[model samples]
Target: MSTVNPNPSAAMLVIGDEILSGRTRDANMYYLAGELTKLGVDLKEVRVVSDDKNAIVSAVRALSTAYDHVFTSGGIGPTHDDITADCVAEAFGVSIDVRDDARVLLAAHYAARGAEFNAARMRMARIPDTATLIENPVSIAPGFTVQNVHVMAGVPNIFQAMVASVMPTLTGGSPLLSQTYRIDSPESTVAEPLGDLAARYPDLSMGSYPFTQDGAFGTNIVIRGVSGAQVEAAMIELANLFPRG
Candidate 1:
């Protein structure tokens, strides 16, 4: 696996009224989370906001400053409600205009179909003046990158392609390593021991996921750490605490 010396932290912004209304489900968050983890970047938070201009602007401003990288999905489409590009520009105190590269790509896409380039279609070409284009293989409407913010498509396929395009250019940190063990015991019996283990390993994250199987309640203990050695050490210590199956 490819790893970096210093890990980066990231956050995602999902902007769409459809998502807020439960009309459309979001698929980008999980995909990005897993991808970033493999790249050694931790996904810190995710926010789902409506298509309101103020909301988008506020989220963009906050996330851009807070995370090493901020990815925004949705609101980059060719419609009046697709105000993400403009909102991002305003948040960054930059201008918004039809970018030549984006326009060329979008124009060619429509022209190939012998379709008219109307105002609706032209909206997709509007990009932040200080941003660079992120190529969209699924569609010609390119995503944009400004500072720490990466604007991408809301559609899963297009968004994923854009992420793939940008990931290669980013700097990553040490990949997190994790281990899971199943214990045929209730959480109440293991909570105190887990707590002690967590306190002993300050650098590791310990979590308990409880479930019921075979008409009995049990908990799955997961330990994660940036260092494989540390995680392995913690697993050994945890196993010693509960030697029997």
Candidate 2:
């Protein structure tokens, strides 16, 4: 029997009334999920909550405690609706204050653009006392890491960049190995064989993604495992069972 390694788990909290109301489509959830998987941090759960303070606070506290890391996107801007930072601080039982480092970054960013360093922009400087800043390259309004929670921007590019900046610091397990095979056959014909292969390679996860195109049914069988050797062997077995014509 193969030994299973303990892996770090994470969750994403997408806080925005726009998303909940379907006004804005969420791109961060899938992006973060893929990035976390690459870092060997399995993204187990995703929650999309409205911009209510209580809702944000409760979700942040719950996910941060349950997973090795929790990421929150949206509601960190300078507008009236932006309240994620304050709620996160409250959830962690910490005080929210204008961080000196963040203030400097924000001030420099605005000054460089010849923009006003007004009260609205200063709102971006408020961060949790116990947190460290995550650098935002596009805009200098810094994201923060308090305990296991990383609060980042809602903009996909900035959020992705922040995730890239933080990923190197985290300890990751073995990267997942995956294989895919495309078959012109219908899913019904392949289901039994797929099940048999899954039983044989119990350590590997198998999935069938089906599609209908050009009046024909097609499926893509994907097998993923932590061990490269196991994944290759399973792919070979699957190929032997379902050879393409």
Index of the highest-lDDT prediction:
1
Weakest 10 consecutive residues of candidate 1 by summed lDDT: 1-10
**Per-residue lDDT for 104-213 in model 2, tens only?**
99888888889999998899999999899998988879899999999999999999889987898799877777789998999999999888878887788888999899
TM-score, structure 1 vs. true: 0.94
For each of the candidates, give the backbone clash count. 1, 0
Compute the lDDT of residue 130 as modeled in candidate 1.
77
Give the distance in Å from residue 226's predicted Cα in candidate 1 to where it truly belongs.
1.2
Position 87, candidate 1: lDDT: 94
- Tell me, what's the RMSD of every candidate? 3.0, 1.8
Candidate 1: clashing pairs of residues: 7-173
Candidate 2 lDDT at 63 equals 97
Error of 2 at 227 (Å): 0.5
- Candidate 1, residue 119: the lDDT equals 90
